[model samples]
Target: MSRLNHQWISQLPIKKITNVKPVSGGDINEAYQITTPDKKYFMKVQPNKTAKYFGHEINGLKALGKAIRAPKPLYNGQINGDAYLVLNWIDAGYQGSQSELGQLVAKMHSQTNDKFGFVDNHETGALNKTNNWDDNWSRFYVEQRLEPEIEACEKLGRWNKWRQQHMDNMISAFRKYYQNHEVVPSLCHGDLWSGNYMFDTEGHPLLIDPDAVYGDREYDLAMTTIFGGFNDEFYQAYQQTFPFDDGLQDRLQWYRFFYLCLHLILFGETYGGSVDSILGGF
Candidate 1:
């Protein structure tokens, strides 16, 4: 924690700052457990240049509303060169049954919008994801989600001739699999891997660190499978609430490939083979 953070916490409209201790599980921001005489809060701080990231979070949580249990945004501001967001501190809780979590997530995904994207952009790990308004899901995903990461991989010397060919082929397959059809612009948690959510003390799920967007709700379900841990019950419950499209199971790898691209850019060759494996399916 920086001294500037301490100063900023002291100046908040609360009782005097009592204690500030470091917390873990955040990918991009420095997190801390802040205590005041009146209450406790979680503070997530990143560079001032990434202030928009925190702002997106505040807006995303507001959009989530009461549909899901998540950290309530209490404050968003800057301290020195860093931007910080304060949220209500939730007590650590044990993981709940997959079925319960799945049904709950389905209820949250029921929220929809007239179009795809968000009011603003969001980040996945360190990379920014554009949520520019587009009514067409395929065009929005291909242009905003896939292309930027592909370009990044090329610039980073990670895209070879064979890889480029495979990516192009995959995109072609994507177009064939998806057309401007009946896909709804459902609210998505955006990044819902195993590690991104937790349960509260009573074993109810509480989402954290959302990169929320409005897109094919299947995009969110697809991510649940990518990182593992979610059991068949979760999928079964989600399906019970909302059934899958005809080819969603077959097209799962393509959407998972997007996250693999993000990992390849963030962590390098360790994730390279995974991307290759997904492309091989096309």
Candidate 2:
């Protein structure tokens, strides 16, 4: 980790810092556990980036926090060419309630907007996500989400004619299916996975590191399945809180395809078979 500027650290309102130890934030940024006399804090730093680098994250945290337990964003600024974001830290715990997690997530998804998108665009690692508002979920998802990932994969030579043909078929099927269904613009944690959730010291589930958007709630639920953390209890609780419509199982595959295709673009062909598996069904 690069050395944090003492001059900048001293200027913060958080009083005298006793310690600043490096912690696992994510692949995209450098994380640290900041200690003061009375409280602890979490921070993420982006080297050579401006304070605006964390703008999307701050927006996401505030949006998610409205309906669920998320880290409270305390401060964000740039110092000596590095961007930093500080948030109130929640102490980790060993046990978590997946049932409660499900209910809370259901509530989070209940928060909705008239249009599909967010106030700002976001980035997952080096990739860009355009979140311009749209009235049509199908068009917003296809044009803003799927096509961008496909274009990136093509640029990296990870895409081919076979994949393109299958993708086209899948897109056609997706558009056709959504034509008859009514979709609400529900808030979603745009990059939810197993690692993004945790239990706090009091056994409260907290969501962290959100890449948020306002879109189909199913898109958020589909992400939970890609990684093996949430279980049957979670889904059951979610269904009890907010019932899913018919034909959801079939539609989930389309959202899964988008996530796997993104992994293929970010992590190469290791995810190709998984992507093809969904495409073959189309």
Per-residue lDDT of 84-158 in model 2, one digit per residue for the tens?
899998889989899989998999999999999999998756468999999999999999999998889889998
lDDT of 1 by residue, 52-82 (tens): 5588889888888668778899877766667
State residue 177's C-alpha deviation in candidate 1, in Å. 2.5
How well does candidate 2 score on lDDT at residue 147? 92
Alpha-carbon shift of residue 214 in model 2 (angstroms):
0.7
Model 1: weakest 10-residue lDDT segment is: 1-10
TM-scores across all candidates? 0.93, 0.97
Error of 2 at 259 (Å): 1.1
List the pairs of residues colliding in candidate 1. Answer: none
For model 2, the stretches where C-alpha displacement exceeds 4 angstroms are none
